[model samples]
Target: MAHREPVVVTDEPTIGKLVVDASRDVSGLIQKEIALAKSELRVSVKAGGLSIGLFAGAAFLGLLAIIMLSVAIAHFISFTGLDLAWGFLIVFFLYVLLAGLLAFVGLKKVKKVRPPEKAIGQAKAIPGAFKGKS
Candidate 1:
């Protein structure tokens, strides 16, 4: 009988190389998940920012409007010889109309803004993840 030694194959990837490759794959997956989360939050943040900005703008407009109305009423009394009481009444009604118009428009825009579609998609995706677990 002749003794034979086993030949070793050197073509296979080493465990170290496999681990490094798997680490890269896992890191890529994590990056993708982070990106998706950021994208989801971005929409909510943008909507919130827009709402806050519009509210602030409306407040500033209201202040400027008060100053302008006071000036106009003063001018009406001084030049048109109108009584201050009548000037005040007219300016007050003008302001009431303008405020109503702005409120209407703002309400319309708010009502038109539907919930983000991503929320619905996420809701649907949630149950699917645990479907076979139980």
Candidate 2:
């Protein structure tokens, strides 16, 4: 790798020159960081979107399979001396019960999801550190 020129600190170096150099370096660093983030974000977003779409398609097909399987189960129930309508209702009622249970569980889980306290605390510490108060 090529070497950078060493900075010469001498009595003649004014504060203004030092500040200007620091500003330039910081600006360049920010620009490069932004470019890197954009490239990474573009690739990550494309891959994540493709995976999400494929998974959604798979879930849709899986749902269809489950529906067909449920209908078969209901038909089997009908063969057990119950009326066809009653057999289907039995399956329907069981599904309703499952739906209610899942809804309750999901709501409980959602209620548990709160803001990320650790991340928020760390973020709040930044300004204090920058201001030399930490």
Candidate 3:
């Protein structure tokens, strides 16, 4: 059975107004932080999902490629007059050459894929970059 002192007075609005303004400011800041957190979580989840999907797709295609490659090698050996061992060796060497070429091209493409600047732009300016700003 205890009553707390009145925290707000009708005649003096200055303190109450300041408190209200501060609360609003704090609430706005909290809301902005929550929004940013949600956006970042969504982006991470999307990137993870994309990575998993790509891996699955690549695995499926790779399996299919293996099947086709075996079939091609078999057809080459049967239809052509070449010996089975020579046919297999030729096919294997061609596959290795193609793989090397693809790896080189892939490396070039990977080298060109620079990360977006938006994330780095949001980071605090380090001493080096802030030297001229100050």
Candidate 4:
């Protein structure tokens, strides 16, 4: 049989040492969590910025397409023997009429909006309630 070394049992850690170690571990854990969150946020922010740029590019292309469609429509009207200038003028007037109609509808919708009376009443009663007056 081989000779074996005697095993020595260590004393239990003191409460103060244990507490200090636990607090240190928790602080390290909090720092690591914060670092991880910052790393994730960096990636998210980059993705968000890229997506906004792509959306802006798409919007610009859509506006260009709309302008081309408007020109095509004007040319089609001129093909019907109307003056080219009159065709463009007719399209311009149509846009103005559409703008006026949208404004009128928007005004009606705005007029229908009412203040939150219930919330206002509750807010007004807050001071009385705080003074123990029901």
Clash totals for all candidate models: 0, 0, 0, 0
TM-score of each: 0.44, 0.56, 0.48, 0.83
Pairs with backbone N, CA or C atoms under 3 Å apart (clashes), candidate 2: none
What C-alpha lDDT, on a 0 to 100 scale, does residue 17 get in candidate 1?
Answer: 98
For residues 4-106, write the lDDT of model 2, one tens digit per residue: 9999776886889999999999999999999999999999999999999999999999999989988898899999998889888998999999999999999
Ranking by TM-score: 4, 2, 3, 1
Q: Which pairs clash (backbone N, Cα, C closer than 3 Å) in model 1? A: none
Pairwise TM-score winner, candidates 3 and 4: 4
Report every candidate's CA lDDT. Answer: 0.88, 0.95, 0.86, 0.96
Clashes of 4: 0
Find the number of clashing residue pairs for candidate 2: 0
lDDT of 3 at 101: 100
- lDDT for each residue of candidate 1 in 1-134, tens digit (9 for 90 to 100): 99999898889999999999999999999999999999989999999999999999999999999789787876776568877777777777887999999999999999999988999988888888779531
Candidate 1: where are CA atoms >4 Å away? Answer: 1-72, 132-134
Q: On lDDT, who's better, 2 or 3?
A: 2
Which tens-of-lDDT digit does each residue in 1-116 have in candidate 3?
A: 79899886577568889999999999999999999999999999999999999999999999999978876886678678877777777778877999999999999999999877
Which parts of model 2 have CA positions greater than 4 angstroms off? 1-26, 103-134
- lDDT for position 63 in model 1: 97
lDDT of 3: 0.86
Q: Which residue pairs collide, candidate 3?
A: none
